[model samples]
Target: MSHRSFRALGVALVVWSAAFTTEQACAETPIEQARHVFETRKYTVVTVQLVIKRQYSFGGRGSQEREEKQEASGTVIDPSGLTVMSLTDVDPTLMYAKLAKTQGMSDYKMESNVTSVTILCDDGSEVEAQVLLRDPDLDLAFIRPSKKPVQPFEHVDLTDAAHPQMLDELLFVNRLGKVARRTYSATLDRVEGIVTKPRTLYIPGQQNQESNAVLGSPAFTLDGRFVGIAAVRADLTESTSLDKGLLAVVMPAEHIAEVAAQVPPLESEGATDGGSS
Candidate 1:
């Protein structure tokens, strides 16, 4: 009888331990759960598009300005349509010129780089978007979809991606925006090299204007937490044009506290796009 009683107690204790663990897991905070998801499923990450209309000298400079539309990509940083983009996508001078005209506040040229405005979702959807804030010196921008758009996307938080260590498996989502075909699942070969340039920027097609910039897409660690914001893919050696075919650039968020503090916590906007090439 004593032996049987001890056996029953041991079984009961095992069951109780398992039950307690499950309860703790189920009671995890949303932030904690989000972080877990980010770490495990970063591949389904999403990006957005910028629909910018600008006028520039075209056709061997007939000395005439022609209007043209250009697109760029962005990473959905939140669920309410807030996103991160490459400030290099917008010419600070042009954004300022456009801003001046829109605000009717003053006529300023090159004063505001043209945040030449437009937006697209990596799931092949297009939404008009506007620049909310910019750090031209750092080549970073925050954007919001216009007309309160709804789209599917996934958001990632920026963590310590720049930490020196082994280069981990990562992914990129590229959106072409009617100019070219969409390409997904471009892997980040490494994260070990450090860039010393102060003003790194991307010009989607300058090196090959036909290339794409899934502008605001997030560069995530294998765990899916946002490690950086996708910027232009440019060669450190050339610095004059983009090399989208062989390279990609990013805005490390760990170093953006100064810029982020200048802006408000943006409204939320995003959805999941977790899949692979």
Candidate 2:
């Protein structure tokens, strides 16, 4: 081979290497930015423990009652330990009723009552909390410590939120279940679409088990701006098909903040029952 030909080949290889490096860096930029938000705000994600007593009745068939303890992910929305989570997770009777109707089981009836509530902190401590508000329309529940924490808690500032366009990527942070040691985890999802009529809702792209995100996971933009929280929107219209009836959406943070603003003071804890429909 001629020396001139060898030199030309070497230059081509170097150019290709530089181009590949630049492409790789650009791909990593979003992930690195998202990592900052995850590490800084992971503590805001916590576990909520609930003991619920449920009653089930099959018309003229029989009735059953059971008490079960469950754990769900919750996001701290205020420094005072005010947290928010999916109301459906705490009480799934509504969802069950919808499913039953869809399956042509009109005789199915179910009711539930939250017997106890506790917030599990990252430091292995537990705080007794009570449901301050429940919004079934939006699938949101606000809870606060029975007694204010001695020190301020790390929380997400919902007021400072970002509005993402369709096809934009989002970062979601959540806490794993007991089997996974309740560790904090993160996942990425894209804004699949936006529903503006009736009410504005952001549709997230398809999620799989590997994402490890749950109902209460908080979502953010790639640049570390708060986006919203994951929730389910159930359409109860009889004409609506089951598949299209229930939708998973990212409820805007501003909407959540509006509801959080209505949370009653701790003194009036039992004014609104969380389990009531």
Candidate 3:
């Protein structure tokens, strides 16, 4: 072979090698960084359980009474054990429907018949909590311990909110249901777009792994900065029924921090009017 042809081949091989190394480095950095973040923040997430009684009607038989339990995920926001969860978990519309049926009333309205609520910690301990308030505008619910904790609980600082650009990679963790031992699984997702009309954020890439059970899970940037909370944007059971299918949205951290800051002062001043036991 000619010396000129040999030199050209050598240049091509070096370029190819450089490209492969760059691709590998780019791929590994984000995932490893995300795993680190998940390990540090996983405990801040908790399980929420609600117990209530509802009435269900049969075709021929009359309505029968039964007790039902619901479960969801929440994020701890403070040392006092203040946590935030998805409003849909205890949505007034659905709760009122159950209540109306139990009362044998025909009108449909919003009401609460929750008999009890409990928070499951990472170490497997449980704490009873009170529902402070549910903001339908934000579609979030705030809850706190009914009694003081023996030790300060682990929480995420919303002040460290992360802002990522479109198509940027991010990290989130989901807890398996009791049937799956309630273990944590880390997922790598991306920001697909942003909505301005409703002041919303969209994550269309993580749809398949999300479920109603994982609502309110905390999301973080690739570097492990807390970004926001994940919520189901459409009907869980009827995803296809919606024109856009099921969308999982992450409420921005700045908005959540602004809302969460209001709760502590209210509790300190002995304001209990907004709470539900």
The lDDT leader among the candidates is 2
Which runs in model 1 stand beyond 4 Å of their true positions? 1-63, 92-118, 122-126, 147-153, 159-166, 176-183, 196-216, 232-248, 256-258, 264-277
The TM-score measured for candidate 3 stands at 0.73
Better of 1 and 2 by TM-score: 2
For 1-277, candidate 3 gives per-residue lDDT tens digits of 9999999999999999999999986778666878778899898888888876555554445666667788888888888888888776755455344345554554433334567778888789999887777776676888888888898888888878878889988777767779877788777778887766667565636453355545788888877788888865543232233335446688777777778777754246443424432
Error of 3 at 188 (Å): 1.3
**For residues 207-226, what per-residue lDDT tens digits would candidate 2 score against the true structure?**
82223257888888977778
Q: Is candidate 1 or candidate 3 better by lDDT?
A: 3
**Predicted candidate 1 versus true structure: per-residue lDDT over 1-277, tens digit per residue:** 6999999999999999999999998887655654564445443344433333334332344333334445555666555566666665554343343334444434333222233455444455656665666765565666665555554445555444433234543344444445346544343434544464673322222222334344455555434455566554332322222232234455566654356555454344332111100
CA lDDT of each candidate? 0.49, 0.84, 0.72
Candidate 3 has which clashing residue pairs, if any?
none
For model 1 the local lDDT of residue 184 reads 47
Order of all candidates by TM-score, from best down to worst?
Answer: 2, 3, 1
What are the per-model C-alpha RMSD values against the true structure?
A: 11.2, 7.1, 8.1
TM-score versus the correct structure, for each prediction: 0.52, 0.85, 0.73
Worst 10 residues of 3 by lDDT: 234-243
